[model samples]
Target chain A: GESVGLHLPTLSVQEGDNSIINCAYSNSASDYFIWYKQESGKGPQFIIDIRSNMDKRQGQRVTVLLNKTVKHLSLQIAATQPGDSAVYFCAENIKGNQGAQKLVFGQGTRLTINP
Target chain B: AAGVIQSPRHLIKEKRETATLKCYPIPRHDTVYWYQQGPGQDPQFLISFYEKMQSDKGSIPDRFSAQQFSDYHSELNMSSLELGDSALYFCASSPVLASTDTQYFGPGTRLTVL
Candidate 1:
């Protein structure tokens, strides 16, 4: 089955440094992509999203780069903070029956920040 | 800003017992989605509803069923629960607009089946 996947299972970065998380997806029909952050025992929180028509999107110290040709996506966080440490997941929105949009999430990457 | 709300933040159920989880979407949001996340795993889509209609289905088990009420709140009912049914259930809601496909997730309900 077509699925979304992450390049690394875990990442470690120092505070004040930049961090990058990568994801790869197989379904070309996907039109929307999003990044989510989940802390321990909590639901995923929306970080940022990018449409397939666009190549890049930016939000509060975060940048999402999408490469349609390779079906790759990356999330970059600036000045990594301790609170930023969590499991990060990337999801692709694919059209389901009846024009419904379904989100397929990738295996998350655990982001660890060191003070 | 309003956010998705989920009831019974935590629940403990015995094997073969039944459990119900409720979700209240943000105001004016007509679409609702349900997902289950196990320990150290990503969220898996269960089912979704659009305007009180069953819109899509995923890896949901036969023992589990869900529906959206007229008021737009959704409920997930699990019967004959098993230990594997213990997980974090998350509810998300979005508007019909395509320009904003971002789904807002609720805090989620933690279910423990013994």
Candidate 2:
């Protein structure tokens, strides 16, 4: 089965620096991607999303880049802050065997902000 | 803005026992999705409903069943639970169920099966 995965399991960034989280998908049929931030014991919070047709999309301080040729996706956070620490997951939208749309989430990258 | 609501933030169940999880979608939202995340694992899609109808199903065990009511609130019923069933179950809702619609998640219900 095609899966979504992360390139790293953990990441540490100094306060005020930038952080980048990477993810890859095995299914080329995936057409939509989203980044979510999960705090300890909390549900995932939507960060940003991009369609396969888009190469890049920008949010408040986040940017999502999509590379179709490599089946790679990245989320970049600018001026990282302490509150930015969390487990980040990248997900892809795919039609399941039953034709229902669902999200395939990555293994998750834990981001730590060092002050 | 109002977001998805899940009841009983924490639940403890014994093996072979049954558990029911409820989710209230954001007002006026018509689509609901359920996912399960084991410790240290990414969330796995369970099932979904659109307009009180089954829209999709994924990796859900036969012992598990779900339904979306007319109000768009949903419930997941798990029976004959095993110790391995302990995990965080999240419910997400979107105004619509589309390949590109953004789904907002609730606080999640943490189930601990002993």
Best by DockQ: 2
Model 1 Cα shift for residue A23 (angstroms)? 0.2
- Lowest summed lDDT window (length 10), candidate 1 chain B: B95-104
lDDT of every model, 2 decimals: 0.94, 0.94
Please provide TM-scores, in order, for all candidate models, with all chains considered together: 0.97, 0.97
Model 1, DockQ value?
0.64
Candidate 2 Cα errors over 4 Å, as ranges: A97-99
Compose the digit string of candidate 1's lDDT tens values, residues B53-78: 99999999999999999999999999
Question: What's candidate 2's DockQ score?
Answer: 0.70
Q: lDDT of candidate 1?
A: 0.94
Residues B16-78, candidate 2, lDDT per residue (tens digit)? 999999999999889899999999999999999998998988889999999999888999999
lDDT of 2 by residue, A28-67 (tens): 9889999999999999999999999999999998999999
Which residue runs does candidate 1 get wrong by more than 4 Å?
B97-100
